[model samples]
Target: MVSTIGRSFNFQPCFLFNSKTVDKSLTARGHSWLWPTAAGVGATAPDRQIRAAAEQRPTWLPGLDPPTYLDGTLAGDYGFDPLGLGEDPESLKWYVQAELVHARFAMLGVLGILVTDLLRVAGISKIPVWFEAGAVKYELANTGTLVIVQLLLMGFAETKRYMDFINPGSQAKDGSFFGLEASLEGLEPGYPGGPLLNPLGLARDIKSAHDWKLKEIKNGRLAMVAILGIFIQASVTHVGPIDNLVEHLSNPWHKTIIQTLASSSS
Candidate 1:
């Protein structure tokens, strides 16, 4: 699984950012490159499209292309502020080694399992035949994803706290860990004033006990999401007919590969 993540899945940094026609691309660059927040680098074909789109925008930002910013921060920083310079070499290196790799492995393991699973879900592959693991499929996948989900939540919670500690403040009473603050916090503040104040103080005010609990809760939520995705992907991956025609392919996971392709091979 670790090997697959290392060789197959490429982790792409993601920021939950969007834009209208209002401002420069400033903060967008740095919005999501945190440890656990790294989404897949993105689909290769789509990445090319994204790059093409950014190229049409402005080079006001340098090093925003593939060969340079392997993590795609340049595109994130483009049209924005001082530009998403990312971090110093040391930190950047750690981000890749520590965060990116972990995320990559966890996410890919879930994905690989799901890829193998899709065949059975869509009626393309049926039980009472070869490659059918029966109910065991669901059980094993659920068990595996449960671990991933747990680890994911743990990863996110630790990541959030680590970022919080390294950063300078509270996350606000509202509870938007990502900083949407009032708009996104779970428990609303007692009064309207909570909306405008810097959350760092409130974040700092949290006791160590509560903080640990909060971390656990956040991680638990992420674990739930990962489990859900794994479930869906598991079913979806097996919903194909390719598994029946494995003799035509050359890859080790032939059934999975053929099923993933858009069309049949000769």
Candidate 2:
């Protein structure tokens, strides 16, 4: 149980997935240029202006197209079975796949803000005492967030379900259910390093209770509490495709990922 439960959490297409997904994502790399970090200058407006200016240069290679990353990953994976083929497929396959996952992973760092809030509210575990004292600790926490974002963007997941890695089970399985609870306990140990609790499952558990009305009516304290908890968690969490400038600049992990994959293509 790592004290930094929420520490390295990120949300990217490939971060939660395995190698196949990573392979697909890398194929979309186009631009290899990186904007070097500048000090003292504002990071927003001038950054945008610089980017716009760079875009006009006809010699510059284009950045990865979103549609390409989205569709490319799928097409490359489906068309060429990298996992089954092993290292037989062209090295370019692995290269593109890695970059794809990396870029998507970088964009997923938006989740860090909420994870930080969660720790501040109710952190799951405590850090080791070796570095728990004052200045070291705060810096460590901030550094952890950056590391988490970096690792996530770099797209190397230790735990990925064969089923979900191939098939994302966003909804409740078994058809009769719209949540994943009955299967929570059965989760492979050490999987994803997260508690298998399902908020949606909790809501579904008491559906038949008191003819559903009483359950949904919020009369029961248990249900009310569960509902409130889910609300607070969701309200604080922002889950969606990343679409912003601040998010793009802070993504150092992805920049390196693309570079590695793009280099492979050559």
Candidate 3:
């Protein structure tokens, strides 16, 4: 009876072997009657399943998966790391802080450039152009002394920020510089929260703070692009961005960016 059953069913004693061994044997022998699911009957290991899941995951760019390190926790994260710079966790942390700083500066720079140009055009102030202001000769004596003082102040602040980044929450809050308290306690590493920083209580909670950060990063990115374009336009046309805009509005067909570049090259 046993011999008849074995001969009729083609039973090869699969119970004696492990699942992986059975799978390998069946696959080697061109047999796939074991597993009949969508995952298929061959090579359904945990790593392969993980890889499939990653492939199915979507990113900012369609049909592409985000990098493994960038799991969409940070604000403004769109998986746009083409150069793979943020592969290491430590380096990525530092880079995130640095990018925030640069973005903030770029936002401020765009505002300053636009306001300076607008004030000049409206005859409110006769200040030099934003790019050329450094070369302007001021009437104040010892301008070099003022520059040195400004540098010292800015350097001190930057050093403090850098130290905070390196050793988080290590700076003392009891110290004062020239009657001004140099305290950044009870805040995030980069954000020095106080009335001066958040007078309107815009970021009252964690969720609100995260939303505000997203908004800030988006606007900061736009401002960075705007400032870069402004620099290029100023260098090419030797005019402020506001003036360029006026020219374009005055004559849309002939005063376009391409035409301006062509005329400048000519």
Candidate 4:
């Protein structure tokens, strides 16, 4: 009975997992041996030692199951586990649709602004200068509003995506701002990870979560650059100070250079 109990307590009291040592030393030890430490003397079995160590873990740690390190070694600090978050596919679908709508709206708004600018700049047809300026300003204002909406939508999408990553099982209720009900079964671990208890399955899910983050980073870069460019163009074209500065840039040397070239050609 003592030997059986000692075998159950078989654990290595170390920060790093060393399977060879743990199995050879802790597992092989019986109740006849005892673990002596600052905590106190206890059964040489790994399980009792692990419990003692876990009881000493800092209370400030966040998340559930502060104990249970992936490796056989005891965890000195809290570890990340995406499975802690319960499954909910509806929230994921809402975010996907929200981002899609924002992307489409942003594309249309930018195209409208660009088309208006092209008509004025190309001078393809006679139109009053004031009318063209007004049209451009109007489009700029509308586009700016759309851009702000896109920014907000992107922020929301990013936040939701992050939450989803941290907790794969999360779900949103029907009729939320994100959209109607939808399933996010793909995000769930059972599909990609295979089984809950398998280490290989857990690793796959973790890797997939990281991949999603990478995709978001790329999308964020593109959206930021496009929005920044739009704002810069609007400022350069419409701001009175910038426009006046460009109009007033003059150099007498330009005329002199042209005249000198003309004389030489003659």
Candidate 1 C-alpha lDDT tens digits along 44-131: 4675676566456444334333223333332122232232233355454444334333444455554554555465544665443223
* lDDT score, candidate 1: 0.42
Q: Supply the global lDDT for candidate 3.
A: 0.71
Query: What is candidate 3's lDDT per residue for 1-266, written digit by digit as tens?
Result: 00111112222223445665554566567665564423434445774575576556545655455666776678887666766778778888888888888889999999999999999977899977898988777788467977998899999988878887888665544553342333233266666654656566566464447778889888988888898999898999998988888889999998898898898899
TM-score of each: 0.21, 0.19, 0.76, 0.26
Candidate 2 lDDT by residue in tens digits, 1-266: 00112221222232344544434433346321221223212236675565454345322124311211122222222122223333333554444444444433333332343344344434453432211222353643686687688778544332233234344452225542334335553222212211455434343433233343222222332333443443443343332112112243577666443563464558
Clashes of each: 23, 11, 0, 10
lDDT for 114 in candidate 1 is: 52
Q: How many backbone clashes does candidate 4 have?
A: 10
Error of 2 at 89 (Å): 2.9
* Residue 226 in candidate 4, Cα distance off native in Å: 1.4
Error of 1 at 206 (Å): 33
Please tell me which model should have the higher TM-score, number 3 or number 4.
3
Candidate 1 wrongly placed segments (more than 4 Å): 1-94, 97-156, 159-266
Q: What order do candidates take by TM-score, descending?
A: 3, 4, 1, 2
> Model 4, residue 237: displacement in angstroms?
5.3
Task: Please give the RMSD of candidate 4 to the true structure.
Answer: 18.3
Per-residue lDDT for 88-190 in model 4, tens only? 3455344433454455455555555555545544566433332244445343468678678889998985675555556654534454334522433233422
Give the local distance difference test score of model 2: 0.35
Error of 3 at 265 (Å): 1.6
- Which scores greater on lDDT, model 1 or model 4? 4
Clashes of 3: 0
